[model samples]
Target: MRKSIIAAAFASLAILPAAASGAEEPPHVDYSFAGVFGTFDPVQLQRGFQVYKEVCAACHSLKFVAFRNLGDAGGPHFTEAEVKALAAGYDVAAIDNETGEATTRKGLPSDHIPAPFPNEIAAKAANNGSAPPDLSLMAKAREGNASYIHAILTGYDHPVPEGVQVPEGGNYNPYFPGGVIAMPKPLSDGQVEYADASVPRTVDQYAKDVSAFLMWTAEPKMEVRKRVGFGAILFLGALSVLLYLSYRRVWRNVDH
Candidate 1:
């Protein structure tokens, strides 16, 4: 009896890992800016911004990004004139410096993007008790970066495995945690038309575009960092060469 019990326990342990591994993993994607010298693609970022504005903004918040950042160096680089126009669309709260009164104003380059809901409670009530996490840090926060984001947004609309029950109002997505998520599948073909005829207007295309955009929001200074690093390497290389020549000159005509 003791040996039989031990064998059963060992079998259970072996099966657990296999069950866990059944969860689908995010697919790998070759992002344009992924290496030491990678830079964000401006057009992809812009299309991503459009996707966020039209769809994800209804639930997710980008509170860390500023209106001016849209035009900032090494980011979306939208012209200042364009940023000004974009800011005008969102109203933000302001305090009257002298009168000590609260007021509303058009968003500025400096202003943080406003939350769609007034507070967490409102957001939870709307989304079946799970307030969608803020997207400002999502790219850096997740394990797979843009690939994970793109996978999730495009993972829905497929059939689920047999006997896997999805709770009422909950969605079944193999890529999401526990194979379930509260938010419904948010993308569909032709959901948002792209202004650039060059880019495709499909669900997968939209997912990829927005994933790139979010990566920029999470790491706005990536381009500047790459540029500075490159310059430093050049300077160090020149210095090394000079030192080597100087050593040879100092040892002129001397036998080792």
Candidate 2:
């Protein structure tokens, strides 16, 4: 027992340095949809889309998603016309099939979400040689869930430490892996007028909404998955009761 105590003490000492290494941690946020039964708040998702459109889309892309996805079942559920209007706001490059030449066309619901830059070189040039990642899977890609994402968005105000220097066109974010981020702080309070007047125009509100939207993009079928899982559990529960009854009845006649 004494030897075990000594070993445990040594282990704690070994771990103490890592725990107290002074790396910054992300703040906590309680999301409405997080667990098995959680459902996406469509209104919040819509607001997030607005944030992305007006703000983040300038550098980031949602390349895997189609504009029509916004109108799909279990999504933000924008109407077909609304999706069309949203798509029309951006233009996409297309090849003229008959002429074999490239052409610019109004974005369509069938088209993938367009990137702000035509290619990686343009994106890199605009963003200091580091292109912003496609955000379709960011909510899933980051180890820090919504809270981590929200913290990174809202945690940019900390002043640079006296010994540290931020690179040109770079910004300081404590939550960023290296405490330096290529993307400047993209959100500010009252940055955009929300479609819903009731939604608050604040950095935190924008972060939460956009984080939730990215979560949906990461798992578009979450609602359906949860519903199907619930139905399967109910069916299994009923089947188990029926099977037990059958066993009891059959055994009743054949006493041990």
Assess every candidate by TM-score.
0.83, 0.86
Candidates' C-alpha lDDT:
0.89, 0.87
Report how far residue 13 has shifted in candidate 2, in Å: 14
Error of 2 at 49 (Å): 0.7
- Estimate the overall C-alpha local distance difference test score of candidate 2: 0.87
Write down the RMSD of candidate 2 (Cα, Å).
Answer: 3.5
User: What local lDDT score does residue 32 receive in model 2, on the 0 to 100 scale?
Assistant: 73
What does candidate 1 score on TM?
Answer: 0.83
**Tens-digit lDDT track for model 2 on 95-208?**
998998999889999999888887889999988889998899988887667777798899889998887788888898878777788988899999989877888999999999
In model 2, the worst 10-residue window by lDDT is: 17-26
Put down candidate 1 lDDT per residue, 1-256, tens digits, no spaces.
9999999999989887547645566888778889998888887898899999999999999999988898876777899899999998889998988898998888887888888898999999999999999999899987788888998998997798898889998998888767888989999989998987877889899999999999999999888889999999999999999999999999988998
